[model samples]
Target: MFKRLLLTLAFSSSIIWFGSCAQKSQTTADQIEKAKEQHAAVVEQTQQQQKLLEEKTRKLQEENQQLQAQLQRLQEEKRELEKQKAQIAKIQKFQNVKAENLQSAQCEINPDLGVPLNPPQAKPGECFAIGYLPAKYKYEKVKVLVDAGGEKVITTPPKYKVVPKKILVREESKKIVVIPPVYKTVTEKVLVRPATTKKVVVRPAKYKWVTEKVLVEPAKKVWKRGRSFLTHAVATRFDPNTGDILCLVEVPPKYKYIKKKVMVEPPVVKEVPVPPVYKTITKKVLVKPAQTKEVVIPAVYKTVYVKELVEPAKVQKIKIPPKYDYVTKRVKVRDEQFLWVKVLCKDNMTKDAIIKLQKALKSKGYYRGPIDGIYGPLTQEAVVNFQKDNDIPITPGAVTLKTLQLLGIK
Candidate 1:
């Protein structure tokens, strides 16, 4: 009985140990499942956090790119501004140089005069002693130095002057006697024959016969029957209607010679005429006698006288005086003078003033350079050109007030 009890106690101890071990294993399994659930929740939270961070990073990169683009645009604008500034500066420098040149040109001195002088003036109706004339004389009372030598009168003796005496003297006066011309008509025979012509005969035309050869028949093509032998015995036949055979033979064309008569040419004859003519005329002869009549004449005589010069005339030399008168005159002492006047010079010129000048020049089609406020060489040249075209005098390199006014610039 004691031995049986000890065996029961050992069996109970073994049962309790197995029960404890089973309980410990169940607890371990439950803890493992809970740990797996917690791990899955932590992984999900980490993935969400990572996605948010990536989105933030993407936005930052976009912002950075935008900032960079803005920076580049600003940089380009800055470069353009710098280029424009450089251009403006260059133009201004050129304008300044041109202004200096103009000033120098205006200050040039005249070659003839050591110093500037005012021009001479002239007044109308001004008199001046031109020259003098020699003393003049007039025709004073002209007196005869010595009476012309007296002329002596020659007196003729008192002899009887033979006067013209016409005496009726008896003289035979001759008279022309006229006799009528006598013409005797003589009869004479002259031949006046008419022209005559004779006719001629012409022979008839004649012709000769000529012999020639002519063709009787023309060349033609003809077909004839022929035979052909073949290695194999074949039937040979002739086409009665078409005259066609295995081989055709050519027939020669036939022709005949013919004679013909032709006329070559004919001969001709002509006739001519001969003529004769004659004429007759008549004439007359003349015979005559003439006589004269008698007339009377008379005698004639004439008388003459002698002459002598009485008182004679004479000539003498005389003097005359020249006329004189007073008149007004005008004279020029000097030419007009050009005086230097104050103007807009380089020292006093400003960008604004230069711009105004440039604009004015441009309006007149003088300044083609840039309108930037800089007064460059081009601007100076424009001013010069403007002055020259307008007939305005250029004063060295100065922008004279006159020039400004002409250009419509203040």
Candidate 2:
């Protein structure tokens, strides 16, 4: 029974020792697992903090790009404003000058000429009447009424022309950002907050945009010439694009589309033309009207005699003239028809035949008026006088063959 008790106690002690060892091992393993879990948590937290820092830096870079773009735009606007100001100053300088000083030459008056007419011859020792001369000379001294009076100066209506006004016009189309420049913008998002300790953080912002304007002077486009004519071509048409405004730009404005400049040369027609410029411009313009006013010249029908020289009343203008081929004259030849006297001239000759007859008669010394070779009344009379004087009498008429033979002409 003592041995049985000893065996039971030994078994119990072994069980207790084994159980204690198992408990100690299990506690050590649990402690190690807990340490591993804490280490993993620390690593995960460090990685998260690093990621947050990277995101913050990326946001900062975006904000910096946006600030740079804004700065560029402001600089561009400053330049444009300065240029515009310079142009305005130049225009002001031009305005100071007057329109009169810009003008050049002048038109003058030409004295009216007085033509001389024949006067009655003056008798000797008679009161020689004052006669008007052609051109008058300015006398330095006034003498007594001289024998010759001179022309008096008179004012004549001056010729005038029209001058048109030319004006420059400006047109503006509102600027539409057809192809607007795209750039980055910054937006902040709260991702994480410090867990260990809270500290106040203040940071200096980067790239603060300050707008500035620098003058970009417009190119001096000198208007070369302008037209001023009576028959004028005044055109007001436009497909024009004016100068840009003072706008700041990070990127240059792009052209989505453009309307090209079109030059239109006006059509010309048949009209009284005028010069482009004139020496002097007069406001008292006596325009010669297209239709005229008929002044009532007093119907002075006092004592007009119907003299030999009759002033022909103007008849409606005959638009056409009578075409003349030839004419046949009637003759009173009482003698027989003289069937054998039928004659045809190569070319009809009235003047030449008369001249031949006269020349033949002169050779025979029976003619005296003229060898003018004309078939006028003088020649006809001479021929008749010759026939009567030669005793070959015939009524007054144009010459014939027998009469020609008698005048020694073939």
Candidate 1 overall Cα lDDT vs. reference?
0.49
lDDT of 2 at 223: 24
What TM-score number comes out for model 2?
0.23
RMSD of each: 74.0, 55.5
10 residues in a row with least lDDT, candidate 2: 335-344
Candidate 1 shows a clash count of: 21
Model 1 poorest 10 in a row by lDDT = 127-136
Model 2 regions more than 4 Å off: 1-11, 100-410
lDDT of 2 by residue, 17-69 (tens): 64685576446544544565565576578667867876886588557656655
Return the clash pairs for model 2, or none.
73-249, 78-212, 78-213, 78-214, 79-214, 82-215, 83-215, 83-216
| Stretches of model 1 off by over 4 angstroms after superposition | 2-7, 98-410
Per-model lDDT: 0.49, 0.40
